[model samples]
Every structure is written in structure tokens, then in C-alpha cells.
Target: MNVAAIETVPLFEYLEFEFLLEYDVFAPCDRGRTRVHEPPELFQGFLHCYYEDVYGTRPVTRELQKPLVWFSCGFDRPPSRDAVDRFLTDLEHVVDDVFDHLVE
Candidate 1:
């Protein structure tokens, strides 16, 4: 199986920010190896980009296809100052947890 693309559809887009997720299954499989092609610009125009622009750096991505699972998340804007702080604080934890769970 092969995934051409994964679309993050916005479930809610308010003035504060946008919340999105993979609404459609881009790849389906009965059995066999599944391959997912990376998008051209994974973080373009997203809050992750914005954070990198403002904060000076983004998370270091570690690719692990051991079990062949891929996951990603992004934010467009924050509703409050606290939200911004929280995101910065929690980003590492989120990445670590994802890596730990997926690579295990």
C-alpha cells in the first residue's frame, strides 16, 4: 500500500486558531507493507512554522518506521498567551511520547 498524501482538514477554525486532523484515511491496507510519501512542505504556513520563526528553532524530527506508523500534529495560532507558553513547554513531551510509543 502507498499513501499519496495525507490531508489535515480543519474541524474548527476560529479567530484564535485552527484545529485540524487527518479526516480521511489516505492509505488503507488489507495486508502487506504500507509506504507513506512525505508531503512537499510538511510544516508550511502552520503554527509550527510560526513558532519556529518566532522562537528560533523547531523540534528535531526522528524518523522511525519500525512498526510503520507515522503521526504528526500542528497548530496555526494560540487563543491566549498561556496557550503559547503551554505549547512551547509541552512540545518536547509530545514528541518524546510519540517517539517512545511508535518506536517501541
Candidate 2:
């Protein structure tokens, strides 16, 4: 899937898109100063843009342009920083795998 490939593009190539993933404090699920609540499965946040690649004439085009994110936790009750870090790291790997498909 293109989603898996976005990360596969060499780090140099990825510089083309303006990648912006942030922990938004203003989303509905974001608690002001308390614990961040779990977003419903279908909740659409900034993260939704990433999957647009799945539905495109050229999925690779969408994957390269779209930004990926995980916006659930907040400063008050943030998810483990390491967990988020690892998720993104894994995502990068998946992107690489997906990229491999593109070349072949």
C-alpha cells in the first residue's frame, strides 16, 4: 500500500513535502488541563490526511504529499512520548517497505 511506501522514499526525497505532525491541544478529544480522552475509532483529526493516498489516481503522489500524525494525547496527560516516537519510527519503516513496491 502507498501508506507503507511514503516512508521508504529516501530521507532526501521526503524533504519535498512539508511534513507537519503535531500534538494539537485544541482538538475535541484534547483535554484542556486534564487527561486526554481516547478518540473514537472514526474520529477524524489531522491524521486523516495521510490516508488520502489510499484513494487516488496515483497513490504514490498522495502519499508523498500528505502528512501523517497521531494526535490523541495532550500535555496534561500525554501518551508516553516513547510510544509515539516508536510509532512514527515504525511508520517510517512501513513507508520504506511500501516504497519498495513503487520501484518494482
**Tens digits of per-residue lDDT for model 1, 37-63:** 211122222333343343422321212
lDDT, each prediction: 0.29, 0.31
Candidate 2 per-residue C-alpha lDDT over 17-71 given as tens digits, one digit per residue, 9 for 90 to 100: 2222222321333344432323221112213324433432233223323343222
Residue 51 accuracy (lDDT) in model 2: 40
Query: TM-score for every candidate vs. truth?
Result: 0.25, 0.22
Most lDDT-accurate candidate: 2
What C-alpha lDDT does candidate 2 achieve relative to the native structure? 0.31
The lowest-lDDT stretch of 10 consecutive residues in candidate 1 is 60-69
User: How big is the positional error of residue 66 in model 1, measured in Å on the Cα after superposition?
Assistant: 38
